[model samples]
Target: MADAAPPLQRLKGAMDAILVADVFLVMAGAAWFGVAVLCHSQKIEAPLQLFQTLWEPLFTPAIGLLMAAALLSGLLGWWQRRGQKRAPGTGS
Candidate 1:
């Protein structure tokens, strides 16, 4: 097993990349919304229109993906820890 990559290393790497992308999308969407709010308050209509146009298609999915990722990560970590607690050779 020395030469082989650790099991799920590639999966973990992919998940890491996806999670990073998801985080960035969520943050970018949030910043865009903030900018839109500022623009709307200042009567700058262009960005407000852009934000509204992108809201349903892009930002919504990004937000959902972030929420799902967070929940899944938490649940998986909890399950992993629970399994470890029952692992062989650990205290009864």
Candidate 2:
């Protein structure tokens, strides 16, 4: 028993894991936003048609949709886990 983590310690560890998940989700969202901006500003079009020719290809929308899904799912999962941790009987 001496080497075992106390109940409180275990609970804290679980909480930390939840926090890490939240952090990772936020970082991924930022990265996705950055990539979208990069694609929008590239020199793929002729001169003087920078903003006019955006989204000509399908990859732009596909990337945006995937990123949106990831963000939405990540937020939902984080909230669900947080609620579970705070529920009754989940004690140290």
Candidate 3:
């Protein structure tokens, strides 16, 4: 079997994947919101209901998860920086 990647490499890959996913989620969410707003403004009940029926149930939890992931990523970066600052022989 091929050797596994180093932990740092694996972490970097995971972070990259998350960043891509975040970008996609933001873009898709914005597009969805725009369409939703347009539908509502035009009094297009059928399309609006269709969009809501397909999107609303997942939207809340997805946003919550996205926000939580972003917060966690920021906090982790902060913690890593703080740790590096405190390591011996590492000049600030």
Candidate 4:
């Protein structure tokens, strides 16, 4: 039917979802690490070990991917806006 979105729109929507998920994971991991640091500074052990457990498997890759995703999203948005700004008669 005519209700379906274009393929590009669908792809962009999926990319946005991935970007949000990456951002959430990175933020949650960083927050957990912060809490672990505070616990260590106070000579307590609330989530020090748990945070370490997540550092390698979850946090590390998520942090790296989040940076890449953010860069891609920024560039994609910029490219889209710039293209939209261009007109048939404009040349600059």
Candidate 5:
């Protein structure tokens, strides 16, 4: 709408981006976890073992940070936009 404020529009875009990133993060983490588990059970080669070994420590923190950041961004964006429907006293 032409009446929409710039800040609210920006917040809405940010919230959408965060939601998409959250979905991608979950999918990637799950895929890596599944691979690690399968490789361990199948007695896979050294590279797979090496990947599993390296992945846990590095990816664990990364995934945590990704999810936390996405959630925080979504919340902050929502909060910023919640009361931003109008500039004060420009009556519709």
Candidate 6:
């Protein structure tokens, strides 16, 4: 079973990377939304325009990626749990 260690470590590393990306995407989206709300409430046109210029292009794709990552992470966790349940000598 020692030979299996590297692949398992790689899988964990990949999962960690994906989770980090998911978190970053969420934070970015939240920050963008907060900026938008602040801009609207403050009636700041120049900053609003600048934010829109940068955010509009990436907003939809970023949301989509965040959602996809969330789903993938959930599925991966579920799959791991299922595998663990099925492993030999592991009781319910």
Predicted candidate 6 versus true structure: per-residue lDDT over 1-92, tens digit per residue: 45656888899888779667767876877786688778889886675566667665765666677778779879989999888878875565
Residue 36 displacement in candidate 3 (angstroms): 2.4
Per-candidate TM equals 0.82, 0.38, 0.65, 0.70, 0.45, 0.56
Clashes of each: 0, 0, 0, 0, 0, 0
* Candidate 3 residue spans exceeding 4 A from truth: 6-19, 89-92
Considering only N, C-alpha and C atoms within 3 Å, which residue pairs clash in candidate 6?
Answer: none
Please, what are the lDDT tens digits per residue for candidate 2 over residues 29-88? Answer: 556556656765884334224333543453355455557767887998999998888887
- The ten-residue window of minimal lDDT in model 2 covers 43-52
lDDT of 6: 0.75
Best by lDDT: 1
> lDDT tens digits, residues 65-89, model 5?
6778778879989888765765464
lDDT of each: 0.88, 0.62, 0.78, 0.85, 0.71, 0.75
Q: Can you tell me which runs of candidate 1 are displaced by over 4 Å? A: 1-7, 88-92
Candidates 1 and 3 compared by TM-score, better number: 1
Weakest 10 consecutive residues, lDDT, candidate 5?
Answer: 83-92
Off by over 4 Å in 4: 74-92
Kindly list the per-residue Cα lDDT of model 4 for residues 8-83, writing each as its tens digit.
9999899889878898988888888898899999998869988888789988888888888778879989999888
**Candidate with best TM-score:** 1
Cα deviation at 8, candidate 2, in Å, is: 1.6
Error of 5 at 27 (Å): 9.6
Model 5 stretches with alpha carbons more than 4 Å out: 1-44, 86-92
Deviation (Å) of 51 in candidate 5: 1.9
lDDT for 33 in candidate 5 is 66
Higher-scoring candidate on TM-score, 1 or 2:
1
Q: Could you give me the TM-score of model 6 versus the true structure? A: 0.56
